[model samples]
Target: MTATDPAMTALAHSWSALSLLHGRIEGSVERALQTEHRLSAREYSLLDVLSRQHDGEGGHLQMRQVADSVVLSQSATTRLVTRLEDRGLLSRYLCPTDRRGIYTDVTDDGLRLLEEARPTHNTALRKALDQAATEPVLAPLVRAVHQLQGDIPRPDDRP
Candidate 1:
């Protein structure tokens, strides 16, 4: 109730502002991924990982690994891969050495989608980073966040 109280003087806006910003990011990425590539955020994330696959002789990351990386259950991962395979956007090749194992490969169609998504994705990311880069007060917080690898999802096309 004091006239000089910091709570009254200073803005109480961060939580709302940050939430709005995050919502915009989620909406923007969702729109771009779906309209431009006919992909959901999760499906686009899966393709993004596979696009990082090297040597095109077909790179296969274990389904379980991908699921854990993206915070999805094994069954969900299986279903996601199944959907992509149905669309000819992905393929599952048996791991030659492990009969019980399989890996997902991004198909040519998946690569095409990635090509469509890359520039838009990069521009969004760079714009966000550019804002972060300007905040000297946030530098330590950003570094601390970067150091946190405790099962956190990497910033991808996923929400």
Candidate 2:
């Protein structure tokens, strides 16, 4: 297809449109979570990942992996982990095989908080999904966005 084709134009416009939509939805979720639970989106994201990560010992996410997943620099991830650790929400352990690598594990307190906040987070997500359902095009759009993410280079890796 030619560059001037309508499909190509639509695809270009879709990129920007989806970006705006994604940011707005994420912002809404962040605000509500911070207001009610005192958790930043980044912290929530880290916890979410750690809660699901498999470490052969327990749930934990390597600091670098979490940093990459959340698009935070290593220093930023370290600071975030420090704050959470101070709050008794997370702990970091040096990897046995790699002394320099740190793995952040959610504390039991963190797990408790996560369990407690599930309702709140679910509510916000449900509200977003409900809003999207009003348009009927949103769920499929979200799936397409996930697909697109696979093709897009990560931000930190991009020039």
Candidate 3:
């Protein structure tokens, strides 16, 4: 495809904007998470999922379930879990019903860290959104992103 092609030009513009926006938002959140809680964004995501999965009593999620929720690859998820395990933030155990299945449970420390980091993460996100809203070219995309995020269902949404 030639650089002059309309379709190619449009695709390039869209991709470039997406890449830049992603980098900025991710970097801001990552920095906040790291500085405040010593957690990576992916780590925060894992903890958030684990916390939400908890039922009335203590609850746990299978390794595969976690891998599915996060953006990380399966191997990367496993490695992250191991790192959290080492830090005593979370624990891994075999599912009682399925001996081969590994389940991850967030420890009290993990929950505490998540709660502390929540404010920083939220602030970073709000700042990003506010910045995007001020940029005429990005405002529409920002709205579209929020709409899309709301449209996506969480695990509890399934029947």
How well is each residue in 1-159 modelled by candidate 3, as lDDT tens digits?
786999998888888877777777888899989998899999999999988875444466666677989977789999999999999998887877779877888899999999999888888876776687687767777788878756333325575
Alpha-carbon lDDT, every model: 0.68, 0.74, 0.82
**N/CA/C clash count, model 3:** 0
Candidate 1 stretches greater than 4 Å from native: 1-22, 54-59, 124-159
Highest-lDDT candidate:
3
Index of the highest-TM-score prediction: 3
What does candidate 2's lDDT look like per residue over 21-127, in tens digits?
Answer: 67767877788789989987788877777777766774556667788988899899889889989999988878888798777778899998887766677667556
Write the candidate numbers in order of decreasing TM-score.
3, 2, 1
Model 1 TM-score is: 0.62
Please estimate how well model 2 matches the true structure, expressed as its whole-model Cα lDDT. Answer: 0.74
Candidate 3 regions with alpha-carbon error over 4 angstroms:
1-3, 55-60, 149-159
TM-score of 3: 0.82
